[model samples]
Target: IGLGVIKNVTLKSGEVNGLKISEGKLAGFIRIRDSGKAELTAIGKFVNSKFFHHLRNSLILATLTVFLTLLFVVPAAYAFSRLKFFGREHILYFYLMFTQVAGGLGIAGLIALYGMLVKLGLYNKLPALAIIYAAGSVPFNTWLLKSYIDSISPDFDEAALVDGASYLQIIRYVLLPMALPGIATVAVMSFIGGWTEFILASLLLTEENQPLSVWIYTLMGGIGRGIDWNYFAAAALLFALPVFIMFMLAQNYIRSGLTVGGLKE
Candidate 1:
């Protein structure tokens, strides 16, 4: 009878007057809830929200962070790799130190950063978030790209210069082409920083502007219990899909970068 009751929606209503039982829509909902159907329904809603609302700001952040990182990091990395300017090593030491410091800031720093954003009227602005992402990524991306460029002999730069090419021209026509893998690596990392960020995204965006990270975090409210596992699962899956696909497409470039850039570090 429970099997039939499972099919019928009336089993949701327990014994009436301690005797009668009617399976109805309530029973159907419960049955469906536990069976993943309800979760799938929630997933659809989550995907729709992601595409319609979050995708806009999230894409904006990703694109700007990548573009700005490439713009600034290429020159900085080139100089670091090829120039013998004073304090260059000291600058790198400071960058590495800053990386350690930033990593240890934890939640307190995140909240403080967000508070300052509000004070500066930057809260809830996607462009502001992009700026932060780009700036924060600088120390790491610069170091990474610099190391990659260094692995290539300075002879490459000299070759271009001997050809009457300007510094900018050499960077544009020579160094950048050779460092394509490293650039792609930095771009992907910057994109991830913008896309998967949760704490900052949550604090910086309004309800209508929240991204997949916030959606996945806030959907169930509590962990392990008092939560709808299906909805959370579905949201998590959707949240990860785009990044996953991109990673697959980028896997080759990433490998080349790590192979070239990894040994230098």
Candidate 2:
């Protein structure tokens, strides 16, 4: 509705009633600014609130998710890529099937997971959240890394073995170096996944233990409190800050990781 009346308005010599329409995209700016004002005006209300604490919780989960994903995915990927073992093909098929299992682990499964966590005394905790994130991410990360690792020549592994270097040493110095971009991709994906995740965070966490996603959810829900939009926008923008930095730092590796995988049999 806001844009409907503006499109056909003929500006008189780039002036609309003495307002310069010729200036930088003022129409779009006005639209955004108008909408943004409501959300941006309450910034002060969010500064010292649970927003920061939730952000810290999110950071802990994202960092731990990355760490755990790397530990589990990297070694699993290397083994799948370089090692020939009994039922290797069957194992790959089973893994691919298991990846499909994640999709079915939806709302019902989330509740069941929460129940199990509560039973184990792990619910409402950052470590519990990180474990969930890592479990969800490991399959795809391992598959992607395996595809990239396979693209690397087996001769590197053979050469390391001939030099009396153990498989672990070869993986550390050779395959790991070759798969650095993929590793960054995995880390970024895990970080972002844990960072933006909402449902589980909201369900499994409480109060200050909640992450930014849930924090923002509650902020948006205070309809009776005339919820401040400025604070909400500020919180959102703050929530996005770390991921933006991650992308800027690993921009090149992100593209390479996605494309380099699946290039070889």
Candidate 3:
């Protein structure tokens, strides 16, 4: 019987008789059906079966993205903070302005640009997201790091220079250790931003590679007949826990980094 083939199935008022079952018979019929189908239906309603895989994939990709952002951001932050160069201020300002104007949605144009690059064989890839995330973080991280760098006494760099240390040596040996607290601050911020970033990742990544934020949004009454709330909450809580832990651990460094440059005489 159709009823035996389907388990835990809910029929509307009209469809009950088409399967030759009255409303009263439907419940008993569903209860006697295969246990596997019943379990599947329950799981589907409870856990958003459509997006469960996407959610898992997003968490993995977001973690990688956070790591990648940190790897690039630290060195770039160091350069912007300590190195004197032509057009430095202009570059900083330009990035600042761009960040201000362009939000998650603003990157749609960039996504199109990426598509064009992809047609030239460069689309829907991890490297593309990495490049965008790194570039996007540069201005803010540069300013943040510059402030921290300014807080460090130039005497340290001067002392290192007197010892015939090259610029690379100075950064590695002298500045980097002193800048650890600030670096920690940048690392936390950049990682969280990338983890929560939805639009660009959603736009740039294919369905198989979509981030958690995008995956969550997929459950909201669009892809299926109804929205699944219980699953959405579970997934959201899982996505948020890491960010919460990261913030709590880095709170002290963030406070110190922010306050270090203030109160100059």
Candidate 4:
């Protein structure tokens, strides 16, 4: 049923009693809540209460994170797949793997990271936050893209080289087209990571720059204030919508990329 149609319907006494059943409890709750309005709820108290700003902040951060990740990962993965440098495998397997594993240091590492950002004067900056997101994404994305690139026959690279294409040209004209599925997979993962991340965002960002993830927390109100379930529900749904749509659109590519990338190595 449409929300507007449901909103206009008046429940009879018997229907209201029937709605008290477990199966109808969720509908009951939604029905009892008022629209998020300034006069009616605490959600309207904050001057920055407009969700558009939070959504725009998230989009900017997520887009920058995806761009930075692809810029660094694509070239690095191509090098790892094509080059014969000394310690290439060792560096890829050991150093890159270590970076991924070290991320588990969690709060301890975040503390140090916070200190460094403060010293660098990048605290609360969106671009800097995107950089951090990109850095964390690099190791795994490089490995994934490299594995996908390795699956592509080196004959393509050799043919491009013989046709007078430089490595950059080959990457742009040759590998990238063939490896698009992998790249899309990486982009989607990076976007979701930046979009839904809460802890780091909560710590690094202030109110004016808060993303939807952190903004939801502020909607919960401070101590001694009654929680507004309706406002929280609305904000949470809005926060989830983009990620849901992206995943639905990209699930096929994600599945194929992961499957094909794993096949070679």
RMSD of every candidate to native, in Å, equals 8.3, 11.1, 8.8, 9.4
Q: Best to worst by TM-score, what's the order?
A: 2, 4, 1, 3
Per-residue lDDT tens digits for candidate 4, residues 1-265, read 2232123223222333222323332332223335432121223222224588889999999999999999999999999999999988788877566666765865669888889889999999999999989988888889988998988989888888887999999899887777878888888889998998888998888889989888888878888977868667877887889888777767776566444322122
Model 2: lowest-lDDT 10 consecutive positions: 35-44
Q: State every prediction's TM-score relative to the real structure.
A: 0.73, 0.77, 0.69, 0.75
lDDT for each residue of candidate 1 in 89-171, tens digit (9 for 90 to 100) = 99999989878787676465887887799899988888888888888899999999998897787777777777798999988
Query: For model 2, what is the C-alpha lDDT against the true structure?
Result: 0.74
Question: Where in model 3 is the C-alpha error above 4 Å?
Answer: 1-37, 40-72, 104-111, 249-265
Local accuracy of candidate 3 as per-residue lDDT tens digits, 104-123: 54555775776676786656
Model with the higher lDDT, candidate 2 or 4? 4
For TM-score, candidate 2 versus 4, the one ahead is: 2
TM-score of structure candidate 1: 0.73
Q: Clashing pairs in model 1?
A: 9-23, 9-24, 10-22, 10-23, 10-24, 11-23
Worst 10 residues of 4 by lDDT: 37-46
| Pairs that clash in candidate 4 | none
Question: Evaluated with TM-score, which candidate comes out highest?
Answer: 2
Q: lDDT: which is higher, 1 or 2?
A: 2
Candidate 1 residue runs with Cα over 4 Å from true position: 1-51, 106-108, 222-226, 252-265
Q: Model 3: clashing residue pairs?
A: 118-122, 118-123
